[model samples]
Target: MDAKAWDERYAGTELVWSAEPNRFVAAETGDLPPGRALDLAAGEGRNSIWLAKQGWQVTAVDFSAAALAKGKLLADAQGASVEWITADLVTWTPKAEAYDLVLIAYLHLPEDEMQSVLAKAAHSLAPGGTFLLIGHDLANLTEGVGGPQDPSILHTPDKVSAALPGVNVTRAERVRRPVTVEGEPREAIDTLVRAVRA
Candidate 1:
């Protein structure tokens, strides 16, 4: 969606996503110590805010100004401080080896941009730092309930891991979780990748 389109979506409501951090996010990083983190495509800053609450310094980046504004407001209301940045990831030159933890959740992009973004995401991780990527699997469009309908854009764990050659992929798997949205039983098929910068 375009900036104006996203602005309109966020402009009308409180926020479509839940205020709490993603379940996968909590499960993966629960054992880690608080540290500097970067959340990419952080639409409403739910994960970023959760990191801040855990005593981690976080930077949340997104292209939509309206989303960032709501994220900031939510952060303030939660008594958490996180650096909010508005930038198009396609052109955003993220600093290499800058973050102890890098979070990328539901950041779907066109096929052409996927390789470059995945490479950039791996490059942005600090040595020994954790990189978490969660997205709707292409299989979800046909086999699962809800996600990006376009199959070309949906990603797989191997696809992401292959895009970043230097990073050591510690975990790559397709997982299923039940999501109940408005009393409807929906299953979300997500491709999750956890890597450590080598």
Candidate 2:
């Protein structure tokens, strides 16, 4: 969705996403010490805020102003600090080797666009810094509870690893995780890939 569409969606709702950090995001990044972090497509800053609470200096980037505003509000309520940027990830150029941790969670896109953005993310990582991605696996479209119906946008561990240059995958797997949304037996087949700059 474009910025305007996202803005409308955010404006129409009190919380577009949950206030808690993504389960994969927390599990994968928990071992790392707090430092400079970048959250791409940081809708409502859930993960960013959590990182901030752990003493990481966080920059949360998203295209929708409304979403950023909501993120700011949540941060304020939590007494956490995060730098918020409003820009399209497709066109945004992050500084090379500028972050200790770079995270992309559930930012599904077409193959070409996904490759471009993930490459930028990998390049933005500092040496020894970790780059983590968690997204709806292609299997989710046919087997999971809820996600974008478009197969072109679903991501896999191989595809995400393929997007990085000079990075070694420490962990890559297709995991079947339970999504405990109330009132339903919901689950998502998602890929978790963690790589580090070489």
Candidate 3:
């Protein structure tokens, strides 16, 4: 969806996503010491606000102005501070080697665009900085609960690994999360990549 579509989606009374940070994000980043962090495609600022409360100076970037505004309200309510930027990830350039932690969650795009975004995200990290990414695994389409059905936007561990260079990959795999499907518990597959810049 484009920025306008996203804005309309977020214009609804209900929050499209939960206010809490993504489970993978919390688990992967919980132990890291506070530092400058970037949350790319940060819809509604859930992760960004959570990072701020954890003491990380955070910058949340999203193309939707409505989403950013909602995020600001949430941040204000929590007494958390975040620098919000409205820009497209494809066009927005973060400072090279500036962030101590870089996070991209569920930012699905075509294979070529995905690679470009991932490359930029890797370059945004400082030496020894951590880069964490989470997205719907390609397997999720047939064997999982909820995610985009288009295969072009889905990702795999191998694809993510190839997009990231100069990093020591700590974890790169298809992981499972439990979700309720028609009141029956089932596992949803997701691609997880955690790396540290060398």
Candidate 4:
């Protein structure tokens, strides 16, 4: 979906996603000391706001102005300060070697675009900075639940790992997440990758 589509989607009375940070995001970053962080494609600022409360100076970027506005409202309500930027992630570049932590969650794109964005994210990290990413695994399409069905946009751990050329990969694998579907419990697969710039 483009920015306009996303804006319309977020305009509904109900929240599209929960205000809490993604489970993988909280788990992967909970122990890290506070530092400058970037949340790319940060829809509604969930992770960005959570990071701010954790003492990290955060900048959250997303293309939808409506989404950003909603995020700003939530941030204000929570007393968490976050810099929300409205721009396309594909065109918006972060300062090189600036962020201590960079996060990308569920930003699905074609393989080439995904690689390009991941490369940019890796290069934006300072030496020793941590980069964490999570998204619906390609296997989620058939063997799991919830996510885009298009195979081109879905990704695998190996594919994601290959995109980060200059990083030491700490964790790059498909992980299972428990979810309830129509009152029945099931597992959803996701690709989780954590790396540090060398």
Among these predicted structures, which one has the highest lDDT?
3
lDDT of 3 at 28: 98
lDDT (10s digit) by residue, model 1, range 1-198 = 877788788886678789999999999998888888999999989999999999999999998989989999999999999999999888897899998899999988887787788888888888888999999998888778788888888989888888875778999999887988789998989999998887
For candidate 4, the 10 contiguous residues with the lowest summed lDDT are 9-18
Model 1 weakest lDDT span, ten residues long: 7-16
Model 3, position 22: C-alpha lDDT score: 95
Candidate 3 clash figure, as a count = 0
Superposed model 4: Cα runs more than 4 Å off: none
Give the runs in model 1 whose Cα sits over 4 Å from its true position. none
State residue 180's C-alpha deviation in candidate 4, in Å.
1.6
Candidate 2's displacement at residue 78, Å, is: 1.1
TM-score for all predictions?
Answer: 0.96, 0.96, 0.97, 0.98
Instruction: Tell how far residue 54 is off in model 4, in angstroms.
Output: 0.3
Superposing every Cα of model 3 onto the true structure, what RMSD results? 0.9
Ranking by lDDT: 3, 4, 2, 1
Model 4: how far residue 49 lies from native, Å: 0.8
Candidate 1 residue pairs in backbone clash: none
Query: Which whole-number lDDT from 0 to 100 does residue 117 have in model 3?
Result: 88
Over 88-139, each residue of candidate 2 has an lDDT whose tens digit, in order, gives 9999989999999999998987799889999999999999999999988999
RMSD in angstroms between candidate 1 and the native structure over all alpha carbons: 1.1
Q: Deviation in angstroms for 183 in model 4?
A: 1.6
